[model samples]
Target: MNDSRFTPVDPVDLTARLVRCPSVTPVEGGALTLLTELLEPAGFECTRVDRNGTPNLFARWGRKGANRTFGFNGHTDVVPVGDAAAWTHDPFGGEIAEGYLWGRGATDMKSGVAAFAAAAVDFVRATPPDGAVVLTITGDEEGPSKDGTIALLDWMRTKGEAMSVCLVGEPTCPDRMGEMMKIGRRGSMSVTFQAQGVQGHSAYPHRARNPLHALVRLLDRLASEPLDHGTDHFDASTLAITTIDTGNSATNVIPARAMARVNIRFNDAHSSASIAQSLRDEADRVTAETGVTFELQVDVSGESFLTPPGDFVRLVTGAVTAETGVEPVLSTSGGTSDARFVKDHCPVVEFGLVGRTMHQVDERVSVDQIRQLKSIYSRILADYFA
Candidate 1:
């Protein structure tokens, strides 16, 4: 790991402090407050971009609208801790044991935020760059995602703030540190199908139109077909049956209505429009055959995007390799993340600690990895401004 001429802010301590906030999704929980307090003293201009009750912070270490601004994006909100009794450590305790920090967001991202924040603060103090360093930390990433980064982006446009390029500090590596990074992400969308038919007694099969049958057939058709083969930087798309329910408890009667939800993770080969149209086609075919009326509701979270190997990508790759002694593979194999939103504003990639235990009962991160990530981020900021 690279050592800086300056003593960086203790990222492990910052991470521990943040983990104790207990900021669940969409809840401020003093996480944003803590960050603002830390950043402002370092000469970073901090603004609270709260919208629709969602909390977000925008901090910049240089002038507004700087020609060359490097941005860091991350979230402090964490998923709910399930079955507190199952935990060996306090979910919000931020305790360090076994060379790991124990907490809810220790892996999912509090450490990442701590690492970048420490690097940014120290870099500006040690050797201030000619350009700007921006940080966009939100409190709604694990929630509906309506007013988090999207809100900050909207506000930035209105106020003439911009970042030349951005890095999202989500957990990107699967098994080891510096083994993988995300240059692109698969698109994610969900479609819910509602079917209507006549309810009738089970004894007379001819009298009842079973909507459940139509839904089952349609789901099978959608799942059976392959979306596409692997692309140059993306894997084949996938469709999964998330839920199916009629809510009908009657033993002798067929339900009149059935509802089902299917989630799809698609590659660059298809857009949400194409996938929705295919679902409509399948529904129409099933309706024609079974006489069951169908209604569809679709939600497109993000579209597949790639930042093609360019200077920005190369910069991050070089710093990572220099720090960790390993060349990370450019991958696009994870679920949806806030990078999906930031891509619309600027080129964004994701890199962070290994995410092997995020969202589990005892979510935690290795203490040394947290320090190593700080070194990598510190190097990135130094190189980006050089």
Candidate 2:
């Protein structure tokens, strides 16, 4: 290790330090301060943004006024540690037993934050490159994401801080570190459909219109067929009906209305608007066929995008293959992240440690994984700005 401060954060101690801060979503819990302490002294100009009680930081280094800026993005807030008694170890203990640093954010990603910070320290110390580097750290990703990465990105854009490329430190790999990378993300959209019918006694079936029957048919039309065969860099799009309700208790009477909520995870083949139009078309067809009145509401969560294969991607790929001898498969799967918002600014991808234990009881990571991740990120920095 050329830089003393760059050695992989003793995964044990780093995990312990971070978990001690009860940084439940929408709370600071001193995690930002801990991060600032580690970064400020290492020549980073850290700016803490407190927007509506949510904590976000924008830390920058290297030469100012540089056109090429490499960004490392991550979230500090973690999901609530549920049912503490169900865990074999303390949920917030950040314990280092059985060769794992166990804690709430250990994998989902305080570990990634620490490792990336350490990598930045190492990169600057070894060779302060000509281009700039920035860290977009937010504390509200685990909850309602209103005040987190999205807000921070708006501020950065207002300041004219454009990035050449960005790497989000999300846990993208499944079982082994460096085994996978997310080159793109599938888009997400939600729909709420309602069917209305005249309510009447079950005994008088001829006079009553049952909305449930109409709703069931509409749902079948939406799910009976696949959205697509799958995109080149993404999986096949899927439409899942998350919930359905009538809120009626009387079995002898027909309900007046039925409601259903469906979520769609789509590939690069479609946009939110296109998907919304498809929903409208489907609902209309179903309504016409059933002779029932209906209403459809669509919430376009995110439009799909991909970071084309480029210099930045190859650099990270080479680094990972060199360090672990694992050729990471670039993929586009999984749930949405802050990356969805960042995509509008610049090409972005996600790569980090194995995510097998994120958001689960006894969340943990091995010390060795942190060390290799630091090395991988360091190499990426060196290649991008060298």
Candidate 3:
């Protein structure tokens, strides 16, 4: 029996309810609880796929081992609310002021989750699909992510659960609601370079090798060179020198070591291995030239991936165009999302609301966009199963 407390399917209302949960990063904060209450009543089978103390919910609205399954992926966790006093509204209040819902995760994607969840619940009730509708919501996306969607995927593989096609409800639009969808994302990696030098008095210039100088030269060379010109389906790769620190307080003394960090967002033209090799080659050249050796640390978050322009891409684009009269661009420009994990399981893409205020103070979303997004998702469901 459905819970009387969970009433009609309304994305905006559900979004407000979710935003009020305060589910920051690895915290449940009652967000997943609300989802279970709503979804279970709508005849969906729900399971708490918690792993390593992180909460994840997996819900399916059809028989297990179905021939075809469509999946929706999202995160309930939000980043911390920095400088809470700077906001015009409470960060967890979920207040609606002047046609907008004001709160953290409003655009970064409680709204996205609400839109898709509402759409799926209503769709299955109205005209049940022969296959299945699966929702994977995680509480660890904003944290280390070692146990969120990755954990769910591992569990699914063990249980023999499968999703043939998946859509990630991440905030993809930069400015407008229906302007963009991500077919792929650039690979991301970070490298930290530590250069060692002999410290000496500033007055004795030649006696000491300044690691700071060598670090700066290496950074300049890496930053000045473009990783590549734009690829056919992707933008040019980029490397950013995020920080260069010598930590030398005394002006007269050369620092014993200098440290710098660089983050690279690369397209399919390059892999982490290739980029790491390039960095090592550059460091080697600098070592030989400046007589300063470097120690490097690298972390590869995810490799670049693309779904390509095909039937599934056309299906989603056609739905977006039909609903909004806006020809959405099939873009591959964005930071990594859980879609990165889903891609290994099935073909995946991302679409959602405008992201202008995501991760910023006074984060908010238009109430109308939430409703419109629900309609778009409903249409996609209708078309995908037609």
Candidate 4:
């Protein structure tokens, strides 16, 4: 049963409660339910935005058609624990020890969800802002993400719900609590190439073509050349060949086909179409030279995006400096987050606790940082409405 008392919000307690739920990706595990129970009594209209069996929560306090809305987006789902026995503390224990909250999702990022939730609840209840405060929480962020934030955004568009500005409560700081904030993210794409050739005995010199040689040549051309130098707010694009396989069993037989896969993290210098075209061109050139036929398949996850250094960024930076005394360095150097989906709707930036232990065993967060994060979020709310 949820304790529905009208007391002040405590982020650490909220974080512990959330971490104990064991809501790994694609699992409800009562995390969303608990959030609804907590927010409903605090005078927020709560809705379950579940799509294709994935759980998402949307809550708002204040007038429905209010002219201004400040949004906070985050995920409650944590990645799975690898080798549960190796943990010093139970992955779902949510135990507080040695000045830290120990458990999975402690830093990435049930604590972040708790901090923002506690701040939003306390701020709306204590000061009662004239505008609306919106929270978009999802359970599919660590999974395929097909039915998480995207579904919420689709529902919001159909229902005419909108925000003037949005902040994603993702773990952005690399080490120190206030050292960095993500203003953008690099685009991610993966491609697989298959080279087809004739199979024959290895002893026959000119009878059979070895597709592995052609595959190696293709990968060498792609990897040996850099995609680009670093962009203004992003690092240089990187392409890594993740896999090369032929699956040939016999020692004396040349395989008929060989395949190679590459994953690319690109900056604003290119788009999915442009990169795909580049790969196709490289494959065509290799095929023309070697007489090896090729087929390529590509999947683009998200395009690179930036909100720029403007009022929203300055406001967040000033709040962080006020609370933590560290002026945050604006960066775009991390993996993708749900912020990629929200960027299309409005300007979005990411900030949260240090992420040194995000997906590792014995994942945890400093208890003090949770309180500091709450204070910073509260200040952002105050300034955004002012």
Give me the candidate number with maximum lDDT.
1
Q: Decide which is better by TM-score, 2 or 3.
A: 2
Model 3 is weakest, by summed lDDT over 10 consecutive residues, at 1-10
lDDT of 4 by residue, 1-386 (tens): 22344577899999999999989989988899988888998999999999999999999998866898999999999899999999999999999999999999999989999999999998888788889999999999999999999999999999989888899998888878899998999999999999999898999937988898889999999999999998888889999999999999899998899999999999999998899999999999999988888999998889999889999999999999999989999999888999999999999999998999999999999999999999999999999998
Q: For each candidate, what TM-score against the reference? A: 0.96, 0.96, 0.95, 0.97
Instruction: lDDT for model 3, please.
Output: 0.92
Error of 4 at 195 (Å): 1.2
State the TM-score for model 2: 0.96
Alpha-carbon error at 142 in model 4, in Å? 0.6
Per-residue lDDT of model 1, residues 299-386, tens digit only: 9999999988999999999999999898999999989999999999999999998999999999999999999999999999989999
True-vs-predicted CA distance for residue 333, candidate 1, Å: 0.6
lDDT values of the candidates? 0.93, 0.85, 0.92, 0.93
Model 2 residue 253 distance off true place after TM-score fit, in angstroms: 0.8
> What number of clashing residue pairs does each candidate have, in the order they appear?
0, 0, 0, 0
Note the residue pairs that clash in candidate 1. none
lDDT of 3 at 77: 97
Candidate 3's residue-wise lDDT over 57-131, tens digit each? 999999888988889999999999999999999999999999999999999899999999999998888788899
